[model samples]
Target: FLTAPTMDDKIKREILPAAVNYYQKRRLVHRLNPQPVTEIAYYTAGGGCLTSSEAVLRPKAEIQRLRETFADGSELYLNFSDKPWVIGGRQIEPLGFYASGPGFEAETGRKDGLWFDWYGDADGCFLNARNYDWLMEPKGTAAMGRGPEGAEPQFANRGDAVVKRGPLATDTAVAVMREADGSRRIRFFPQKQMGFVSIDLAASGFEPAEVVALDAEGNPVAGSLDGVERGSGTLTIRHRDPRVWSFRLTPGKGRTGR
Candidate 1:
């Protein structure tokens, strides 16, 4: 039941041209595609960082942050506290107002001080005392290996451990990140760096992970950088994209791949 005026307003607000290129394969493309974004998905998926039904609020002595890590290594985080926290030096806003029911005690706990805040999946999305009239669209995935239980970072210092990104090694770059729902995933960049780059996997909080390289046009480079091995605090590589290269990270158990 969209009125003409409402429809017009939506068209004005939503129609962001995906690409400006008019000539594509020669047909003189006119209409551009809208980005594949389901605005209400997060709300429908139960709002604040969801976890499996079996997941429980971790012991106070175990994890210290509220995080939901997927089996694929992707992780999500949420903060309701006033204490400020930053992923890649960028401070994030806390979720909207919160209140609980009569018996609902706002129990708080932190795990072994490593990283991770766990909670049980209450029947459906926890319908805590949050304003339902307004929905929030969470943005920005954790920048890989800025040294937290965040994604985009697979393996940093192989044996040591990295808490923040250092200058020496190039970040685990994600060129065209496609979300699980097939939409484009957004990424954040840290301040510009100049000169040599060095990375120690363990120091940066990356586990042993498998890496694949993709070239500019999204084609995997068959055999390149064979000398690169898992970082054991001394690994070094040119700190920049190799002519628009994207690295794909997968769960690699041991020190195997090149």
Candidate 2:
């Protein structure tokens, strides 16, 4: 079980996975307005190098569709009439705490990694709109993903193979990123010319992936490059937010550096 405080009682404690499950089970009778919603503005302060920007999203048809599909799961954005939120905004304290049995985990995973260490453990938590439009309420107020109107909506397992030929001639490294919910993930595979090719992100100012050489059957071939002619290198990208990601890459021989 977890403990959390609300506006009424910053010291109040709540139950856990049961708290989360109760809402999920009661979702059948709950629903938000069927009207369209909009994201007039959004803000974020410097929580870190990653999430420190302001973004104004005009809900496109695709974004709207995504929201509608996940309505059941309270994953959609909700209007916080009195609260002012920024992109990197965090509550002064948790709103409430909930408890769960052994089968409770977050959609992101165990939350026990170097990256999440400073984020805290078993503290307070809250449920708010995803895109952060105070006037734009979600279809449902449950704390889970429902459908396309839900947070993760379909949560569909998509598997596809991509083949491309471009500046990235050789293969390098590969990785698969799985969310805690055990649904969607992004795969990174090394390309011949480009160091790393991500099935998740496209080209950006972010660092290119560290490309390793690969053999004939697409197996990683680890070796060192001595001269500019060998044509080998590395790249890494760190995330600040969903929209902003960092990047770095190796310039081929005689090429201008980024």
Candidate 3:
């Protein structure tokens, strides 16, 4: 192949010239003496150059013979193809990055998992870095107090969890459930906080009704929600200086627009 002005220039300087010479000698000899010649291939243990897949499949004896005769960085062609050739094999190395632990929220009742990202300043590209969620805990705490899993080795988030999509901005109606004795009760939060927060409802069904925010204790906080037939139901958390938010919803019941 023709060399580009950039990367291929380095390829030409390092491996192509010698490979052309080696092939030329072989071709001349074949033209003069019609005897069969054994084809020898060289494989890169790590890798230095590129040619073809078959280049790395020669017998041990043949490969040794070629190596002993040629210099370390030599390149050669498979045949008389117009393509530029390199003698040595390719080079490979390990890939590297950074990892972090999971997160949990009390008010929202949602647990965020361990996460990871590439290590470096904001600029450099991460070669093969990926964003992953860990379901299990880390192995152990460092002597210096490091790692996300509470500085203790435990059955922390070790597996990946599926990313769940929250309800859309639109108001959607959902089911409401209460024990027959009214002792046990539950409520839905908006799509955003619903997974973690809970809302207190007077009853179910889409109607102009008052919805309030409640803690795990079931005591109602300040503020009320405007109920809608469609879209996620949102209740503004009142007491806290900056009001928190949650969805008013329920499952098992069919479609309620949010």
Give me the candidate number with maximum TM-score. Answer: 1
TM-score of decoy 1 = 0.24
Q: Give the TM-score of candidate 3.
A: 0.19
Q: What C-alpha lDDT does candidate 2 achieve relative to the native structure?
A: 0.22
| Best-to-worst TM-score order | 1, 3, 2
Q: In model 3, what lDDT does residue 26 have?
A: 26
List ranges where model 3 is wrong by over 4 Å: 1-136, 139-162, 165-178, 181-210, 224-258
> How do the residues 29-107 of candidate 1 rate in per-residue lDDT, one tens digit apiece?
1111111212111111222332333234533222222543233332334444334334434333333111122221111
Off by over 4 Å in 2: 1-153, 161-249
Return the lDDT, model 2, position 97: 17
> What TM-score would candidate 2 get against the native?
0.18
Q: What is the lDDT of residue 7 in candidate 1?
A: 26
How far is each candidate from the true structure, as Cα RMSD in Å? 17.9, 20.0, 25.8
In model 1, which runs have C-alpha deviations exceeding 4 angstroms?
A: 1-197, 225-227, 231-235, 239-244, 254-258
Q: What do the candidate models score in CA lDDT, each in turn?
A: 0.26, 0.22, 0.25
Best by lDDT: 1
Model 2 Cα lDDT, one tens digit per residue, 1-258: 012312223212322222222322222112223322332222222221111122223322112111111322323321221222222232211111111222221221111110000000121111111111111112233322233332431211122222222111112222222223222222222112223233212211122224333344534434323111221232222221222111223323453221
Error of 2 at 253 (Å): 2.8
RMSD of 3: 25.8
Put the candidates in lDDT order, highest first.
Answer: 1, 3, 2
